[model samples]
Target: MQAAISFAISLVAMSFGIAKLPLGPWERGFLALGLIFVVTSSFTLAKCVRDRQEVTEVSSRVDKARLDKLLAEHDPFETKNL
Candidate 1:
């Protein structure tokens, strides 16, 4: 998809930029490490958000089903036996 393509392009561009930097190899290695950490953290955050949303949706569905079942069993005009 477009998002995948964009991500790839950006990663390549960043790598090239880092390679072209005048800094020492150690600095570049540090920057690459930071970039990797950021990317991994971003993925983790996105997965966590998705999982939470899915849980919320499932909880809502269960609540709605319970309400529907209660309503189905309810009878407004039924008189209770003494």
Candidate 2:
């Protein structure tokens, strides 16, 4: 969702550069904002991919059945001896 917004803003600003075919204050501002949006979005995308890879790596090291048993033992409905 954030990536989409950033891309859209960047595209709109770039359109001004292409349509006007002249460099001016507003056009320059738009160009700068567009570049910022692209860079920020790219960084965000890279972070998301990196985090996902880390999670995949960690999950692969765990034993699924043991994990499930631990989850079941911690159930809120389970009675505990005080």
TM-score of each: 0.88, 0.51
Q: Kindly list the per-residue Cα lDDT of model 2 for residues 48-79, writing each as its tens digit.
A: 99999999877876767677888887878868
Q: Candidate 1: misplaced stretches above 4 Å?
A: none
Error of 2 at 17 (Å): 12
lDDT of 1 at 12: 88
Collision count for each candidate, in order: 0, 0
> What digit string (tens of lDDT, one per residue) describes model 1 on residues 1-82?
9988998898889889988999999999998998888888988999999999999999999999999999999999999999
RMSD of each: 1.3, 8.1
**Model 1 worst lDDT window (10 residues):** 34-43
